[model samples]
Target: MTTDMKQVYAYPDALTEVEMRYCPGCTHGTAHRLVAEVIDELGIKDRTVTLATVGCSVYAYEYFDTDAVQCSHGRAPAVATGIKRVQPDTIVFAYQGDGDLASIGMAEIVHAAARGENFTVIFLNNAVYGMTQGQMAPTTLLGQKTTTSPRGRTAPEAGFPIRVCELLDTLDGPAFLAREALSTPPHVRNAKRAIKRAFETQVAGLGFSLVELLSTCPTWWGMTPLEAIKHVDEQMTKCYPIAVFRDRLAAQEGEQSAESAPGEGE
Candidate 1:
């Protein structure tokens, strides 16, 4: 008798065997897996370098199998810019959270994008700070309650949440910018596609590419894993709509295709 057994899924080679330390309901693990899968699929594991920033993802260096550098709190972009400049041939990327990217490292990211830095950025926006307890982050939604905003985030006092993708869209440096959630299977699949495109943008010598993932911190959000997922789908998406804000490479490809058409303006 012959028996056949098929392997449905397995961990990507781009990820180390280190066990994840994220909370049980947190989505940082999911985001890390997607990025690793993209790196593995692109066959760039050996040439890839990651800048792991502070916040909940401070330990990213332990998860990704590629070479990783730990940057000061909110300084991943600055560090990544230096790495990419020194090693242009290497595929450089930064993994950052809302607290690290949109809060203190805002200037670094803005300047990097403005300068058209050649690198990839994986931004995880979970609305609150996960490392130092549940504090209100720059991307914290209005009326959202956290340790810092126990009474709920209010206007004038707490100010409005910073829309990173839309904010970067106003700049003319980035070659690609997109946002996706990781609440469901379809959403997770789309997130992987966006991440792959971001990496490809860098390989094509395009400008900075950022893919913001709307993730969840169930532990900080005071909700179960399932509730956190639902919150990402039903609530977080309301503030940060999933869409591609920019794609210079795609635009250029379209233009090229149009020019090659058999007939035009006839």
Candidate 2:
């Protein structure tokens, strides 16, 4: 320890000491830490619960220091809905990958958001199904290669990459919806902010909230970490376009106060 040097970042107590099983350069572990940090920052570690269904993050319970549940594939949203309803004060969040979320869990997520479930969803979109040996996922980009799609995904065969944020933005029940990237340091910071806001939305009882993170899969993508991150920046962002699709409560209180002021003055 050096007296003059300051530690800019410290491990969150909300995260366990378990070694992550994700491949090198995989961004799932980074995303997990951000959620754990948010829980610690909000002083909700004791009351927070994380749900992991399937895909690469199925062992999420081992890494997060808070309460955790392993749900059936694509069923985390359903489980989270139940938890939040029965124990409304608890902070419930589901950590899901594209294959587990946007594929088999599509109906569950859509209906949950439509019903305005008060919970947060941390979605990881690495463009391929990393757990299943690099198969094409719902978020797979056009012409992206994978073990299942050896010749690259085509429009006719795979349709198109699902823009989840855009799809959910059409619904009115969501309190917040955002898409962010984890390719680099700056982008990771932005992603963390979005994750925090999503959790805040749940805590405020606003409604269903979700943050989609564009991550990397260096092993499955057959590229170095640098190249994978570059691909996320140059290609995946073009398809997903990092943006906050909706925010229900961040500014409404102040705006409502200001609006009432004018009426009172009158």
Highest lDDT against the true fold, candidate: 1
- Per-residue CA lDDT of candidate 1, range 86-142, in tens? 989899999999999999999999999998999999999999999999999999999
lDDT of 2 by residue, 1-266 (tens): 89999998999899899999999889998999899999999999999898977989999999999899999999999999899889999999999999888999999999999999999999999999888899999999999999988999999987899999999899988999999999988999999999999988888889999999999999999999899999999999999999999988766766777888765855
Record all residue pairs in model 1 with backbone atoms less than 3 Å apart, i.e. clashing: none
- Would you give me the overall lDDT of model 1? 0.93
- What shift in Å separates residue 204 of candidate 1 from its native position after superposition? 0.6
- Candidate 1's error at 184, in angstroms? 1.0
Q: What would the TM-score be for candidate 2 when compared with the true structure?
A: 0.95
Clashes of each: 0, 0
